[model samples]
Target: MTTALIADDEAHLAQYLKQQLAACWPELEIVSVARNGIEAAEQISAWQPELAFLDIQMPGLNGLEVAQGIEGATRVVFVTAYDDYAVEAFDAAALDYLLKPLKTERLLACVARLKAALGRPPAVDESRLAETLQRLLAPPVQGLARLRFIRAASGDMTHQVAVDEVLFFHADDKYTVVRTAQGEHLIRTTITDLAAQLDPEQFWQVHRSTLINLAHLVGTRRDEMSRLFVRIKGHAQELPVSRAYVHLFKAM
Candidate 1:
């Protein structure tokens, strides 16, 4: 029996795919279900399943990153809400794409192709998906990211720090404290507003009062309660990595 892993952010969507897979390939064994790309990567790496159903977009690592992370281990059937550069890359790489919400017929067809591909000595798509992932991991562009200008309360503080340099942004009662390589400064912004403005790829909403730059990420390890903590540069304090955001490091 073929073992499979399914990864998607939405719990309902993952459930839907589970049902579809059960119908399409009753004999198949689903080894694991991951709620996000990062979790998927960890499970895929650990289980090394023969087949994986991966969603193309997610909060932290994204589907492409997870796929590239599990390079030669499994055959991928990409499930994406919409097509983009990643889809084009997948097509060029000769891998299959399954648009979401996954249709039963399309899923069955994909399974059939996977079975065929498995029969033939797996023809791995030796494409540049790794390079694509590297690009995705890079710090996002200026306009695409949310930035705060920091000024000194005293004289001659003309330089404004880029948001990328920030270690963390804390929300006070009426102001947001922006901490960076240089120092901390007060900015008039709300965590909610900043979250909306920030690029999801660059800055992760770790908590209600905190936003962290993935580029500055140093390490993540489970605490006493199986909760995760993230360490960042420019700050000695380790921040909480909520379960909601835990998937961010699964691939890393």
Candidate 2:
């Protein structure tokens, strides 16, 4: 039996896709379902599924990084909502993909191709995929205006801080902290919301509740146990990087 794995941060979306896949390809066995990139990467490495359905913007490593790290024969079918990603590039690379708001018709076509491809040798070119990811990351997603400033409240005083000055954004109970070299301010905005508004190239989500400005990054540190932590310029404290996002700093 052909085995597969589905990886998406959204639980409901992953379950829905599983249901749809059961209907579309009843014979295929879905060995695992992962809710984050780290989980997905580990599962893929352990199971070595014949196919992997990867969501492009997953938490932890993100889909591109996860796909890049795969060393097995698992063929990938990208599941993404970002229409800005070049469809022609995916096609040219012989990579199958399903767009968000997935249609049964499109999925059926993708399933057919995958089924046929499995009968032959894996033809995916990892180098091509890497190049594609490079291009995709270079261009900013259109239609979303990058946040230039934040208005936050600190005790009795409200302050306006330029987005560039922000060292990091950390979740603190009911509010999020807007930290800069000068000081910190509390904001009602959630970390997830801030991530969406911030420039993709500048701000990187290091944890579920933390987003750091790469420009202000001092360096990374590892403890005795080899756990990773990130240091910010002008900030005395180090921020913990989640296990899932540790791959982001491996190059450092």
| Among all candidates shown, the one with the greatest TM-score | 2
Question: What lDDT does candidate 2 reach at residue 2?
Answer: 92
Candidate 1 whole-model C-alpha lDDT, 0 to 1: 0.70
Tens digits of per-residue lDDT for model 2, 1-252: 999999999999999999999998999999999999889988987898888899988987677656655645677788889765637446533358888988999999999988888888766554455455544544434576779999986678878899999999998767898989888888889776787779878998776568999999989887765657889999999987754456567676
Per-residue lDDT tens digits for candidate 1, residues 1-252, read 989888889989988989888888898899999988668877976887888888878765577656655533477777887767546646533257788767778788888888788777645434344334434444333454354544435355555777767777877656888888777887776665676677678887664457888888898867554656788877888886533344456778
Work out the TM-score per prediction: 0.52, 0.54
TM-score of 1: 0.52
* Candidates' C-alpha lDDT: 0.70, 0.79
The C-alpha RMSD of each candidate to the native structure, in angstroms, is 9.7, 8.2
| Regions of candidate 1 where Cα sits further than 4 Å from its true position | 92-94, 132-252
**Residue 200 miss distance in model 2 (angstroms):** 24
